[model samples]
Target: MKTQRGDIPRRLDTPDPAIRFYLFHGADEASSRSHATRLLKAFGAAKDAMEGGAIKSDPAKLADEANALSMFGGAKAIWIEPAADEIVAGVEALLEAPGAEHPTIAIAGALRKTSKLLKATEASPHALAHISYAPEGREYENIIEQLCREHGLAPAPGVVSRIAGMTANNRELARQEVEKYALYLGSGESDPVPLEDDVVDRLGAGTGDVAFFGLGDRAMVGDIAAVQEGVDAMSANGSEAITILRAMQRRIVMLAPMQARVAAGEPASAVISSMGRALFWKDKPVVTEMLMRWSAPRLARLGERITDLERRMMFTQLPAKSAIGEELLAVARIAQSARRR
Candidate 1:
């Protein structure tokens, strides 16, 4: 059955001998990696299994390896690392088959809410859990609270909101920011450490600046010349195309929720404050205007286009600069579209 990320801790404790296949799918690699590690530990090394690549291309080998007799027995756990579409199809077949020996765990880099794999996993008789790194609704705030609690501290008033705003649904990054603050405060402090604006600034600098801020500043202001120049500079600096697309995708994804929050009569300060202290005062106007200009549907479409471009880059032997230029054109179009709308 389908389960939420929060429910994962409880499910891991269950004593069921039935093979459990967990599909940890999310945009955040850190969260996915962490979940995979937890699964490996719980099932024990004996019965634990891990695989990678396209499933269909080598189904026989995958099946053989996954179904291999457990070294120590007890409960078996099979983990399939991030794979191509073909491999995902093979996994779907395995999930459909009757009487599999061991519980299979298939991890996806990202899965859509309505994906067939997600649906099958949810419908399967076997145990299925989905851990999404996408922070939706109250999840962002919840994560901040959880992080504070874990560090044995309470976030000062508005601190949680501030951190959430800066991170913008990037759970792994948010966690890192909180951990940084926690460390800065040192262990076993007498009282809860209140985050100051400077703390956020330091964290942002350490994390290579707000990537979106750099991209959006050029893109939103209709500075095509500057955008091209900046892109060239970034390429010259040896930044990967995938990294650029991923950052753009993240910012676009964040804008919708942010826009919605703003429309709901939330104060600009409150809405912006929800973002961690990492955001600079200079970024506010550009980001805010871009949010207004780009509708949610448009941003979602742009994100999908970027995903396709990234996939092509990964699977094919295309020249990185050309492929990246194509992706940048798409970003430019989004900016133009935002202006027209």
Candidate 2:
């Protein structure tokens, strides 16, 4: 039941009723999440929102919810934001239970190929699983176009690329911008209109500069001083701890598969080169060096630690900035040690 990212849109257009759950996981968690919601958006179906951790302790809770009767007498949809391996048993129960009245969607960050959650989801006949990497080139354009359509905008030619550029190719940004267009166009879920290029100009005129990702870049190269400096600057500039931590986690997700490829004996240069436009050309040199430095195991462990830190920031009353900053500095020290040995 593993689904390709390209086919996600078409499948959403005509979702299978027999499919009880959709698993969207990969490096591009934002995109994965947006896509997961598109299913509900498309059908105008409201979701019973839940966190991914809800079923970790009570494995049967997932199955119970799936079979629960909606008060409004409709098939309810369950949405689990930020899915993880802990929910594998719960998802297994949902899959095995007969006649799940609700469909479920679980969005996750990068998952290992052998992940129990991923494997269970893929193996289930009742679920569809997909991995989202950052989209590149034509795929980027396609994602924007699809978002516009889902949000009820009928963007004209050149409109998609302009929005893509204005949003700096961030799919989530592009999605939000398109929602603005839908509002401007007086468009609705069922009624669409011409989303001219001029509309992009009027609404997207003040789109801010792309976010700084140097904190992650420095951490990968084990530049402790730079990492600390970047964190200080960001904190002074009023950046949130969760935001900073999320950015670092993204770097971990982005490097993971490439590290694996290198661990499998592929040349780092070749793997980086093969990324084509998926990776920013300006960062290619640094990414290549880091890929050489961080092995697959290291990257995987780092990803887990970041995920745990991010979860704590969400669930606990922790000082976000300092905790996240400390994590990044620790990562830098580890990278520096790797350099020495």
Candidate number of the best lDDT: 2
Off by over 4 Å in 2: 145-162, 185-202, 205-341
Best by TM-score: 2
The residue pairs in collision within model 2 are: none
Q: Name model 1 segments beyond 4 Å from true.
A: 4-9, 12-16, 26-31, 37-49, 53-78, 84-104, 110-124, 129-133, 153-168, 188-191, 205-213, 222-225, 233-341
Name the weakest run of 10 consecutive residues (lDDT summed) in model 1.
204-213
Work out the TM-score per prediction. 0.56, 0.57
After the best TM-score superposition of candidate 1, give how far the Cα of residue 142 lies from its true spot, in angstroms. Answer: 2.7
Worst 10 residues of 2 by lDDT: 205-214
- Cand. 1 TM to true fold: 0.56
